[model samples]
Target: MSTGSLTGRVALVTGAGRGIGREIAIGLAAEGMAVGLVGRTHGTLSDTLKECVKRGSRGVAVTADVCRPGSVREAVRLVERDLGPIDLLVNNAGQVDAAEVPVWETDPTQWWRVVETNLRGPYNLLRCVLPGMVARRSGRVLNLNSGFAVRPDGHYTAYATSKGALLQLSDNIADSLARYGVVVLDISPGAVATDMTAGMPMFRDNRTWASIPYMVAVTVDVARGRFDGLHGRFVHAERDDLAELVEQAEEIRRTDARTLRLRPYKDDDPMV
Candidate 1:
């Protein structure tokens, strides 16, 4: 869809206080979409809302913890009341383990906390926002996933597990909502230089970081339906050539190549 096509549409973005969420909200706003900034801190959410307004788009700042069902419900109600029915939902709020440690060594509370935020938070938002989308028979949902969702990470077990589950959630929801004209996508920004990444030990010595502009561009493309063909699949902004991906989308869908699946030991394996 073109920039003009996006005008007057509404988007609800969690974790819009900072990092990738903040950038995505601003990007969508630049395209003329009304934005609802959801975050735990009012100051940061307001900061992002200001940027959206500065871009000549309408927006509202909603301070709410995504992990809480009541808060998420209220947030959705408020955003819809203020901006109109949400045309898009961006589940970007997440958290990593406080320390990189083996599962056995990880604090149980902290592990659950990470899972609650990364997994439950999105579920909450989906539960609250999907009804309207399905009722209208038009909407898009983007989950900010990670490479860890597709791979194993011994050090950040909680983070990895939560992301993996989130990917499955996206796939299942996409299947259930397809007839309703609701699309769901899992997008990974790679290792962008964000406060979250800065706190991770793995990137301490890494000189390379994903391009923020590129990440935002890909997100905007998804928001505009450019990547709708890849719905219910994974998109990695830093590693994927989107144009090439779009070209291959049909084949990818036919082969179910980008989705998570159990690999059978052999072609004749019973699982296959």
Candidate 2:
């Protein structure tokens, strides 16, 4: 929660052009990190870059599509060239295009596209970023997961599958990379009022909507490695304030019981 917590950090945020991504980039910038904004649209990326600058820190913008390996790799190169070695990687680029359609009725191509962006994109960044972090013996990688990863319904099968796979990948990487001091975590923002959720029926009730800035705070906490003790874990934004959530995770880590493995929970499951 300190103003300079991320002062020397350089963060690369995917999907940084708009909505939650833009807010997150700005939030990190406000925290004093040099932020690299990555997005496919030049206009949106430029807008985000300016906003990030206005938010009071160094920033750069890169155009890239997460679904394409070449694009993602190029974005990473650009970030390194413009910013610095990424101290933090926020895998926030993904879409839920298949959310309203039943799995059987979903277009195969679109479903695969969703998988490529939602799952493969994170993997691509992790593969590229891990070596440097491992060699340095310090870094943070936060994979943006979703509530649907566990509580998936018929309509969200493809999107949820992608997120679920991502969560598994995060856990596996955390387990392997811990010795090297690289911490990987899966964070679900959950029901934020971003462009992606504007038209959702649930958003019709204002009381249920969460603002983007709050989720950005969660990203800030995650980037700070607050949940380090519970590496390979998932945190829900709605559960508690950032520090309290981290403390809860630390408590879970301290249990040290053989039978206390974290079972991925459904969205509707009681958090208590």
Candidate 3:
């Protein structure tokens, strides 16, 4: 993790108005990447962009909703126009409105809204950004995910379902885009202080929280393509050491670890 590893790179971070998105965008700017802060609120996005500029790098704020394809396309165009081609796209915009409710008890509209924001948001960005990256044969995408995506869960069907699908989407895109020199990563920034998690019952008063710097450092590593071998796989900022993971990169690729999949009843189960 050298200083300025992202020098000359351009990154666009969604949900950058505040919280983890804001922190990571500022962190990337501190690493010398020109950053574009995207959010629905212009004033708040501007606030984050100012913080990034304070770190001594180019930072622009764009107001756009990730769930809207046209808005996302225009946001990408704006970012590229001002900051140069995006070297990294951080898909951090997400929703958790139905997070605390059971599947059977949640409102259909609200639940689907959560799914659309969490799942469709990144797809909208990719539909607009992937073509340019493929043509240029360069780019990287980081999908903000959750461990709950695969682990057992209760009263969080919408969030878990969307994240699981997002994980699969990351793997598929990684595999399809690798030949073009692009990589896709599934990063689960552990329970940190964010608007999304500040009210969680588990962290109501827990003074000690996961370090934002750790996740930012890992993201900077991903931005630099340091763990490309772990592309399409998942990593937890608070759990996995980037250096150690890089060391074990080959084994991870060989075994396809950190991915979501289905397992049969037994290893000896015969295939059709």
- Could you estimate the TM-score for every candidate? 0.97, 0.88, 0.95
Model 2 lDDT per residue over 1-272, tens place: 43878887899999999888888898999899999998889999999889878767898898888877788788888888888899999999888754477788888988899888999888888777777889999998888777777665677777888988888777666668989998887777878877776765445576666656778887887788767765777766765465665557657656632111455488666752
Sort the predicted structures by TM-score, highest score first.
1, 3, 2
lDDT, candidate 2, equals 0.80
Give the alpha-carbon lDDT of every model: 0.92, 0.80, 0.87
lDDT pick, better of 2 and 3:
3
Which pairs of residues collide in candidate 2? none
Candidate 1, residue 114: Cα displacement in angstroms equals 0.6
Clashes of each: 0, 0, 0
> What does the lDDT read for residue 120 in candidate 1?
97
lDDT per residue (tens digit) for residues 3-113 in model 1: 655798999999999999999999999889999999999999989999999888999999999889999999999999999999999999999998988999999999999
After superposition on all CA atoms, what RMSD does each candidate show versus the true structure?
1.4, 4.8, 1.8
Could you tell me the C-alpha RMSD of candidate 1 in Å?
A: 1.4
